[model samples]
Target: MIRLDTGAITEIALLAAHCDDLAIGLGGTLLTLADSVPGLRVRALILTGAGTEREGEERAALESFCPGADLDVRVLDLPDGRTPVHWERAKEAVGELRRGGDPQVVFAPQRDDAHQDHRLLAELAPTEFRDHLILGYEILKWENDTPRPSLFHPLSEVVARRKAELLMKHYPSQRDHDWFDEESFLGLCRLRGVQCRARYAEAFLVEKATITFGGA
Candidate 1:
C-alpha cells in the first residue's frame, strides 16, 4: 500500500451524532495524531447529550483521547435518534462550527451509516465544509452497517490498547452495552489492521480529498 500523509494538520473538526461515537470510531487515530502534532486544535460538535451526564462523559473522553491539544467541544441538546426532525438546528450547528474555524481535516459519520442521526449529520457536513478533506468514521453497532473504508490509519499496539482503555475509563455510562467492552473495540481495530497489514488500525471512508502528485 502507498502511504500518504496530510503534511501538517494543525486544526481538525470532529462531528458526531451521539456522545461516544467519536471515541468508538476514531479514538486510536486521535491518539496517534495528538502525539505527533504539538498544540493541535480540535473542534468537536455532537448533536445530542447536552446538559447531561453524557455530555460530561464526552468532554472527559475527548480530553483523554486528545491529550495536550487545544480541544473545544460543543454538545447540542437536539434529541438523539431524531436528528432528522431537527434538521434545521443540526444544519445551523454545523454551519456555526464551520464559521468558527477552518480545519485542514474533518471527521464525521458517513452518508451510508445505518443510524438516522449519523446519516443526517454526514449529509450536512460537506454542505458546510465544502472545500475541506472529510473522513467518514464508522461506528460498530448491532446493525450490519460497517463500511468498507477506503482509507486506513495504522495504529501502534500501545496506542490501540490505550484507546480501548480510555474508552472504558472515561465512559462509565456506556459500560453496560454488550458491544462497549474492550474485546469488541480491540477486535475491530485488529481486523482493520489485518486489512492494512498492521497490528492495529482505524479505518475511514474518504468522501473527498485532494492529492498533490508532486512537490510545488
Candidate 2:
C-alpha cells in the first residue's frame, strides 16, 4: 500500500452523533496527532447528550484523547436516534462549525453507519465541509454496521492500551452496555492492525482523496 502523508495538520474537525463516539472511533489517532502536532486545534461537535452526565463524560474523554491541543467541544441537545426528524438543526449545527475555521481534516461517522443519527451527521458533514478531507470513523456496535475502511492509522502499543483505559475510566454511563469493554475495543483495533500490518490501529472510510503525482 502506498502511504500518503497529510503534512502538519494544524486543525481538525470532529463530528459525532453522540457522546463517546469520537473516542471510540478515533481515540488512538487523536492521541497520535496531538502528540505530533503541538497546539493543534480540535473543534468537536456532538449531536446529542447535552446537559447530561454524558456531556461531562465526553468533555473529559476528548481532553484526554487530545492532550495539549486547543480542543473546543460542543454537545447539542438533539434527540438520540431521532436525527432525521431534526435534520435542519443538524445541518445548521454543521454549518456553524464550518463557519468557525478551515480544518485540514474532519473525522465523522461513515455514511453506512446503521444508526440513523450517525448516518445523518455523515451525510451532512460533506455538505458543509465540501473541500476538506473527511475520514469516516467507525463505531463498533451490535448492529453489524462496520464498513470496509479505506484508510488506516496505525497505533502504537502504548497508545492502544491508553485509549482502552481512558474509555473505561471516563465513560461510566457506557459501562452498563453489553458491548462496552476493553476486550471489544482492543480486539477491534487489533483486527485493524492485522489488516495494516501493525500492532494496533484505527480504520476509517475515505469516500475520496486527491493524490498529486509530481513534486511541488
Q: Each model's TM-score, in the order given?
A: 0.98, 0.98
Give model 2's TM-score versus the native structure.
0.98
Candidate 2 structure quality by residue, lDDT tens digits, 1-216: 557777778999999999999999999999999999999999999999999999999999999999999999999999898979999999999999999999999999999999999999899999999999999999988899889998999999999999999999999999999999999999999999999999899999995678777754
Q: Write the per-residue lDDT of candidate 1 for residues 1-216, one digit (tens) a residue.
A: 779967788999999999999999999999988999989999999999999999999999999999999999999999989989999999999999999999999999988999999999899999999999999999988899999999999999999999999999989998888888888999999999999999999999998877788864
lDDT of each: 0.94, 0.94
> Where does candidate 2 stray beyond 4 Å?
none
Residue 28, candidate 2: alpha-carbon lDDT: 96
Where does candidate 1 stray beyond 4 Å?
none
Error of 2 at 134 (Å): 0.5
Please give the TM-score that candidate 1 achieves against the real structure: 0.98
Candidate 2 whole-model C-alpha lDDT, 0 to 1 = 0.94
Per-prediction tally of clashes = 0, 0
